[model samples]
Target: MYPASYYYRRRLPGRSRGKGLIICLIVFLMFSTGIGLLKLINIQQAIPKFPLLILGQKGENALNLMCSAMPLLPVSIELNDESNNQSSIQLADILVLRLSRVFRLDRQSPIALLEKELPVPVEVESSAVPVMKAAPVLPNPPSPEPEEPRQAQVPTLSEECLMAVYNTHTGETYALTDGMDRLQGKKGGVVQAAAALEEELEKKLGIRVARSDAINDDVYQYSYAKSKAVLEKLLAENSQIVAAFDVHRDAGKSREESIVNIDGEILAPILIIVGSDARAEFPGWQNNYQFAKKLASEINKQYPGLCLGVMVKDGRYNQFLHPRALLLEIGSVSNSTEEAVQSARLLGKVLGPLIREIYENKQSE
Candidate 1:
């Protein structure tokens, strides 16, 4: 029953009043918070109550922007899980790891602080994932995180690369297990055994062994020829490598016939091969032969006949590269990767004592 203009004007003024009330309430709340924050002069004490107020919140966004153009890294870190704040730390690493994909970071870097640290014992990839992938042929068993592997690195030791190992015929596979005897151009069981030997030696003895993944068996006959080149390069770079082994596989032998009983456990046989001067100019071939003999004797002493004795070949299997260089036929084509790996591990077990002897003696000289 009022005039039309009067009602319209009244409604507009009521809406304006409501908006002003909201603005005033919001300003009052903000002003109160600012005054409360200003009262706390001891900012350090406040950090415990409110962690996300400082670097943990603001630095994360900046870290993401920084690692976008950074290089790959190899990190040696140890995560501290001894506090109740482990969950928060983990959440922080997750946020940072999920934020940027630009860094293939494994090495030590400034951005590494955002991630949890891991010991450089077991092999790790450039990222968080493991480096070892199950071969298509070998049944990928669930990798049990063994305790021994964690206690791998010896506390008192000078970490130096002491030995070099490579596979001349990396394509030699286990036919019974791998569905093929050789992989032609791909890495085979021999390569895996060599890798196992590297890891085992590092774990058990803390000896840094330089190993190669050079695929030299693509053509089979030219394997030695190609591997010689790889060996030359490796030895040239690592001049301190006094000992080298050309890891290979022997064909035409079954699993049963290729094994040796060592300490009640069945392991693949190892054959030490010494090259001759008949094919190539090998000056110190006999020294290598004597070393091979000593190595064979050591293996035999540990587990009699585990080594199939040292075999001297007419061809210079790249033994001419170094005085301590020798060839090792890990197992036959019929041997499984497990057997091969165990055998290689056994070799590492025995080699630790003799290797330390050789190394320490050389260092004294």
Candidate 2:
């Protein structure tokens, strides 16, 4: 073994070194733990407070604050004075106190400062709220007026017979089954043609017409006298008859003289003959001639070449009875009765307005 003092000295050095190392290690550990604890505290302080969700009820004036992240804790704030003995406080005042405590806001904050600066409430007696009145309804606008009915454009003549139509020669017939000239007892085609003309004047034109059904062929040589008697009877019965027609058939040898084409419709030519007896008896022959010329002009205007011009003859032809009387000869013996009937219809159309004019003139007179 070495000397005793030397050995003790070596042991003491090792012990001191060990003690210093342990003390240094302990101090470092304490310092690190303190830094760790400080960091943890800083992290906790950095987190924001939970937001409050306020729910309120009307009339009761109560508020509930809800927290989404944490369970809500009940908080009571005294806003009314305890000494005044008031049991309930205004909800607006309670909200101010709760917000101040939860947000840790001071009097300098806007909400807290505004609450302190606002004046106290005053009590007033309540009355019933007035109801809003509805606006008055206006009456409906007037309906537009109904239009007046239109008047007919055609002239309206008297309902009584304004004209008379009679056949002088009842022996006249047509090519439709009946030969051209069938004397005595036969209802001649000229009668049929006259009847068609009568129908158009009375029914279509609203003119009253007097038609003679007499067969004057019993005295063919004295046909004019017999027809004159028939016309006088008609005129006697109807004083309103202002005009008369002695309808006859011509004795033409060819169809060219009697057949006329009007708007593609084949019709017999119409010949109006005015008689001038110039004798002292028939003084109104000039007036009859004037009327026939006017009527022929009108017919020609409606149907070109329909009237083969008016014939002025020396014989009286019984036209002296009426100022408007005339002898109308339809298509010749060569022309069909159908053609004559068609021509008669067109003649009635032209005569209707003419007769109306004459009737009106008589009224004015």
Candidate 3:
């Protein structure tokens, strides 16, 4: 023990120097850590927050600050109370918090801190993120022109007058010309005679004739009734029809009674029949008789003795429908079809002139 003061002084210098070095090192370390933390905070504050672009319904206006780095996303942020600026800020904060959670940000991130402080539930859907494309601008379209009104068309009446010819007993056929019976089938001798008359009236006399090829009734008993309907239809359709003739061949009558000869050519005699049955709805039978008389007289003047005179009967025969209605028996069943055809042609020649005269008289009246 050389002295207690000497040992104490020697140990004290070393210990004091060691303690001072440790304290200075601790202070320096704390100061450096604090300075580094402050620098990090400043850098974070300096970096700009990503601006969210909100598009309006029309897509012609923007709702937030424009940022070049931030990618555009089609997000519908329906802030019904958008007039309040506080609600808008709260929504932005919520969006940032969701982004921070999705990107797995650092625990000390400002966005993450905000997420913890927010009162609303933070449900981030990582799958439903929509990428938005900028809308294209279009030019205005041109207006349309007005259309014109259309005109209506009118129907014109024929220059030449028309005549209607039809067969009452359409099934009355010929014997030798059209094989088999004369009282059955449509291809009858009377039909052929009427067609020849129609052709002569049209081609030779320049008359417009409408002849019906309709088989009125298959059964001969109901022929007159059925033919009346056909005649009515013809007269209704053609207002120009001046006369209607029902051509037929007399059955079971003598050949001498029905045949005639004109200029060395054998002919079928034409008989003009006038219906005079006042009780059968024919009050205008006298007018029909007068027409028959005139027509018969004309036929006789043209071919001398071709007509066998007029016969007054007691049946309507649809003569009441028109004053010029005539039931003409061309020939008997025994007479040949060639004779009947010749008679029909001769009739057309005389009848065409008579019809023109009657029409002219009516027009003059």
* Strongest candidate by lDDT: 2
Question: TM-score of model 2 relative to the true fold?
Answer: 0.56
lDDT of 3 by residue, 118-153 (tens): 332344576677868778877777666666765333
Candidate 3 yields a Cα-based lDDT of: 0.69
The window of 10 residues in a row where model 2 has the poorest summed lDDT is 61-70
lDDT of 2: 0.71
In order of appearance, the predictions have TM-scores of 0.58, 0.56, 0.55
Give each model's whole-structure lDDT. Answer: 0.70, 0.71, 0.69
Question: Which residue ranges in model 1 land beyond 4 Å of their true spot?
Answer: 1-152
Considering TM-score, which of the candidate structures 1 and 2 is the better prediction for this target?
Answer: 1
Candidate 2 lDDT by residue in tens digits, 306-365: 999899988898888888899999888888889999999999999998888888888999
Candidate 2's C-alpha runs over 4 A off are: 1-156, 278-280
Worst 10 residues of 1 by lDDT: 69-78
